[model samples]
Target chain A: MSSVDRSQRSNSTLKTLNRVFVYTILIVSSLMMLIPFAWSVITSLKSNENVFTHSAFWLQFPPDFSAYKEIWNRIPLLKYTANTLKVAVIVTFGQLFTSSLAGFAFAKMKFPGRDKLFVIYLATMMVPGVVLLIPNFVIMRTIGAIDTHWALILSAVGSVYGTFLMRQFFLSFPSELEDAAKLDGCNPFMFYWHVLLPNAKPILTTQGLMAFQFIWNDFQWPLIVLNSESKRTLQLGLSYLMSEYYTDWTLLMAASVLTLLPIIILFFIAQKNFIQSFKLSGLKG
Target chain B: MKKNRERSPRVSLLAKNKIREALWGYLFISPNFLIVLIFTILPVFFSSYMSMTDWNILSKPNFIGLENYQHILQDEVARETFFNTFYFSVLSVPVSLILSLLFAVFLNQKIKGIAFFRTAYYIPCISASVAVSLMFMWLLANNGLINQMLTSFGLGPVKWLTDPKIALNSVIGITIWKGLGVNIVIFLAALQDIPPELVEAASIDGANRVQQFFKVTLPLLSPVIFFVTITGVINSFQSFDLVYNMTKGGPGHATTLIGYYIWKQAFDYLHMGYGAALANLVFFAIFILTIIQWILRKRWVYSEE
Candidate 1:
């Protein structure tokens, strides 16, 4: 009994030491990951002289909003933001509608070749977006939709991943609800509209948030498709700022901060759902 | 005869419902099917055909029959880009997997303030790539924060992006930093999925902590490890926006990964057919790698019986 007590004391001490070590590493790495972003915020608030002379960690005596003002005046910041909003909102709603409809069909509906078609859809996820970039661009150009939001919206509306996600959620749903609805003489559409969708609020929110994040942050596709100054998305606008004011770190940082604001806000608002969805999707993969 | 008569009418009614259900399924899936077919499916076939042509996106695509593929093979820039892409993935994927796993393991500990650390770590992942890139561009500048810290430690300032020799590695570091959160979260979930009884049993059998981790926990975590590695490889191979925004494959083509290369060819140079061929090659490479990993998964992944 004495030996066991001694051993337990030693083990507890060892665990405490281990926890200390782990916490140290975690704290340091977290700092490393966050310092750049913190630095951007600081630099954005610094005067040009302070930005170059003082260390990034140094706080400017008088914070400057001139950089933000400069960026606002120099570019159509609000317009670009509105453009991004339009694309993200459209894509989110579009993907939710399409993915849920197809997801329900693939999940609950019985039809010939259903499984085969679902497999094909799953296979499409493996094809890298880069492969489709040129052909899609060509198609869009052929149809004269280049330099338009239509290109961004139309191309991104169909999401195999989102459909797959919704289908998985739907598959786990209990069938008794549907059976009861059917017994009440409700058709499939009515059952879906009144029963399934209402029950799927959590998943719908998750998918909507994810779709918004994706479409809002997307750069390459929009960069290729939309070129007009007035049609520039937030990301494109930020990139444009980067090139035009390559040396103006203050302005660039300001632009960066503004660009990330919405995503960060969204993340804070839906932190649990975002993290949960990521875990779910990662596990599914 | 009486039972057969009783079931016959019900079977006919069921068949009718089945037919109607099938039609409804078709109707429900039509929107997705049409979009995917027009944007994804048709583009895939069209690109494959384009790969064999000499189209410049202006004139009609004249059939060239494998010339673009041959050009890709002979082109030095394409070769360099492919090499850079392979180098980035090979270096980044393993590092990302290990770091994220380590993070997950440590973060899984029941410690005070763990939530704060988790959120801080994940903040980078939530930020837009362009924003992250711009932030890094500042931090990596010659007299930037990172360089300032290095100098304070008596180390010389390393040209993070300008020096071609280390540019790709720098980009890889940033990518890894930004990507660590999602992988850690996945790993945390996987770690949680591991049954506590196995570890307790191992400890009861006199296994040390390290021994328990190796003998029990690691085996249980192999499926997630395999998954993270496969997805890591695939995603790293498609690295584009970071390189594009940061270096534009600059300093004499040092950081030009295949995705960026394809973009430059198709968009910048307007060699649509050639770009299509390169894109196809990338697709084939990813497909082959995925297939190989799927085949090999049986050998290494711990089967959850």
Candidate 2:
């Protein structure tokens, strides 16, 4: 009995030690992940002279907004932001419509070749986006939409992953609800519009957030398609700034901060939805 | 006879409704189906056909069977880009898996401020890649914070993005940092799914923490590990945005990942046919890797159901 007491004391001490170690490592690594963004914000507010001279962790005594002011005039910041917003909004809504419509068809309807078509859609998810880049570019050019936002919006409308996600959400939905709705004289389109869609709000929000992120951050495709300065997306604009203002760290950091702000804000507002979507999609593997 | 005659009309009406339901299904799916066919399916075939032709976006494609493939095989730049891509994948994927698993294990512990820490880690995953890369580009400058800290420890400054020898590794570090959040979240979810009773039993049977992790927890987490590994490789192979933003495949051809190489060939250099060929090769490479992983999964992944 005395030995047992001694052993229990030792075990508790060991557990305490383990907790200390784990918390230390977690705090340090989290700092490593977050310090860059903090640093960007600090650097963005610093004067050009202080940007390189000040210690990275140091803030200038009087924070400067000159770089922010300079970036607006140097580049068409508002125009680019508007363009990005336009593309992202259109793409998000387009993907939601297409994905949810097809998702409902796959989940609740029994059309001929439905299963085979779903398998094909799944296969398309594995096809590298690069494989379609050149041909799509050619096709866009042939159709005379080469420098237009139509290319961005149209290409992003059909998303296999979004459809897969919505389908999974629909599959988990109870069929009895559909039966009751049908008994109440609901037609197919009415069932989708009034019953199914209202119940699918959570998954729709998740898909909307994801689609927004994808379109907002997308660089390569927009870079290939949009040739004119007026048509450039926010990312393309940032890349141009990087090349032109390679030495202007303050202005560049300011622009980067401004570019990332909306997404970060959106993320904070919908944090749970984002994490939940990841959990759901991650488990599908 | 009267009841049978009454049921016949009802049965025919049900069949008619079934046909209408199927038609509605077709109508609902048509918009997505048509777009996918026009954009995805047609481009796949067009891309394959373009791979065999010589075209420069200005002229009609001229069929030159096998020539583009032979050129790719013989090309030194192509070989270098392939090596760079393979090197990045090999370094990034396993390291990401291990580090993320470690972080997930740490975060999984019952502790205060866990949610805050998790959010901190995941914030980068949602930020724009262009912005993140630009931020890293600043942090990696010779006189930047990283170098400042190094020199404070009596070590000389190291060029992060310029020197070809270490440029790829620098990008790899950034990529790994950006990717840690998603892997941690996935691993955390998988870790939560493990029954607490299993670990309790393991500890009760005289297994220490390390032994419990290896014997009990590891096997249970194999499915997620497999998922992370396969997706990691695929995403690494498709890494273009960072390379484009940070190095521009640069300081030489050191960080020229295959994705960037294909872009450069098709868009920058106007070698559409050759780029199409390289893209096809990338598709095949990923397809084969996925196949190999699926085959290998049966060996290690614990079947829960």
lDDT of 2 by residue, B1-305 (tens): 99999999999999998898899899988888888888898889999999999999888889999899999989999999999999999999999999999999998888899889999988999888999998998898887889989998999989899999999999999999998999998899889889999999999999999999999999888877888988898888789999999999998999999999999999999999999999999889888977776677777665432
lDDT of 2 by residue, A8-31 (tens): 999999999999999899989999
Candidate 2 Cα misplacement greater than 4 A, ranges: A53-58, A283-285, B1-5, B295-305
Candidate 2 chain B weakest lDDT stretch, 10 residues? B296-305
lDDT for every model? 0.89, 0.90
Q: What's the CA error at residue B234 for candidate 2, in Å?
A: 0.5
Span of 10 residues, lowest total lDDT, candidate 1 chain B? B296-305
lDDT of 1 by residue, B1-305 (tens): 99999999999999999999999999999898889989998899999999999888778889999999999879999999988988988898899999999989888878788888888878888788999999999999987988989998999999999899999999999999999999999889888878889889999999998998888988878877888888887787678899989999988999999989999999998899999999999889888877776677777765432
lDDT of 2: 0.90
Top of the candidates by DockQ: 1
> What TM-score fits each model?
0.96, 0.96
DockQ (Cα-based) for each candidate? 0.72, 0.71
Tens-digit per-residue lDDT, A24-130, candidate 1: 89889999988998899989998877777877568886788989888888899999999999999999999999999999999999999999999899878778888
Q: After superposition, how far is residue B297 of candidate 2 from its true place, in Å?
A: 5.4
